[model samples]
Target: MTKTKTLRIDHVKHPMGLLSVHVFWCVAFIVIPLLFILYYMMIDGNGSLTLDNIKYLGSKEILRCFGRSLIYAAASTAVCLLLGYPLALIISRMPTRRQTTMNMLIMIPMWVSFIIRTYTIKNIFNDNGIINQLLRSMHILEKEGDFVKFLGTPGLIIFGMVYNFLPYMVVPIVTSLTGIDNRLFEASADLGASPWKTLLHVTLPLSRAGIISGITMVFVPAVSTFYISSTLSGGTVTLIGDKIETAFLNESNFSRGSALSFVLMILIIISMLIMNKFGDRNVEGVAV
Candidate 1:
């Protein structure tokens, strides 16, 4: 019994043993849960195999939901890229202490509960909220019923996405910018490249990985976010997430929910592959 216990301890300490443990947990948690999704995707309420769930996604209303999700996701990502790239560049060039402080400031918003933050925004932009109150105080509006209509608009929904997800975009790009060798900039200057030219050639290409990473991080959540749309737009904006949510929650249609989830996974996977292809292309031979 002593010898057997000693042998068991040694096996547990082995590298392959650790790997085996990891595999066991992954199969139990990740793989098994995914199997459930697949099972539902292929079966109806009565547990009979059916393709109807898959076909439902191809319907016009569902297609419109998907299109809206893609558009909102793309728009939010573009806005984040435009805003975050410059902000990241600025942060990367700051003194290390300042960089840390600035990064914390950027991250502080995320520490707040997202639902609470959304409600805070809701309060600020509601019909009798701060903006309208201030505007009315200044006598900028004559009509009592006239509010700026900030809530329940496409723009506000996109703004909420950008606000919530901006830190994810900024941090990755900052890491990438800071990783780039400073000598590349010197060489570009020595070769008589202007500041803008150096930035376009030397800086952007090197930072492609972070840009793609940020895009993926933000876009993935933005596309599937039901809360932001539901809260900010009051369910007026129906993205694919709203559709999937409605299927499962309101309709109790597990098969339809799983099918929508499966297609969304495929769509996101295909997009990531394309982005990674561009990000991984060697920039070694670009003229210095």
Candidate 2:
């Protein structure tokens, strides 16, 4: 009985069993949709899995959309990091009560309807909007023309992405930052390390995993987002999401859409890999 128990424990601890379980879980969720798309593609992908379909994706417009989506996602992630990091740092330094209150305020926006908020932003950026009115009234602008070009531009889309994903970045960073022992910073200070050096050497390194997670969460969704960009940029900004929508709706081609969607997934995987590579360098001491 003792020998059998030991053998069972060894078998259960084998890496293969754990790997199989992990693979099964992944298949149950991620792989299933991909398999469905693949099966659909093989069955009705433009009568044949021809290079023409692939070539079509290589067209200037589609390529441009793909690049634009990457650019937008990257820009959004950068903006979110810049804006969220300091806010999270400030919250981390606050007393427990104040931090809780500030966190609630930060999350309050998430409860709002995304579409409604986006439309409100559109109104704010419209030619006859509050900003333009304020600028004109204050004589900051000689005329109502070219005040900021907020609407129907990349800037608005970037703003929308930053506004929406700022919470994602802040939450992760705060989680990681709060996990850090405050004594480490105190010790660094006692050792005469400058504030910047302490952050660079200690705080920032400890929060790397959170930074990577936030970047991934922000960038991937932003890349796939269609409505925010379309609404803010007035349908002029071509993105990979726009291509997927057009293929599915305008072209009435599910196969092409699935293919484009697959490509987008690939792009996300690549982006995640790149981010992980950078993040892993300092992740050794960071808690999961």
TM-score of each: 0.93, 0.83
Total clashing pairs in model 1: 0
What are the RMSD figures for all models against the true structure? 2.8, 6.0
- For model 1, the superposed segments whose C-alpha errors exceed 4 Å read 1-8, 11-13, 282-288
Clashing pairs in 2: none
Tell me the lDDT of candidate 2: 0.82
lDDT of 2 by residue, 62-111 (tens): 88888888899999999999999888899999998998898899989989
lDDT per prediction?
Answer: 0.89, 0.82
The worst-scoring run of ten residues by lDDT in candidate 2 lies at 1-10
Model 1 local distance difference test score: 0.89
Best by lDDT: 1
lDDT of 1 by residue, 53-86 (tens): 9899889989988998999999999999999999
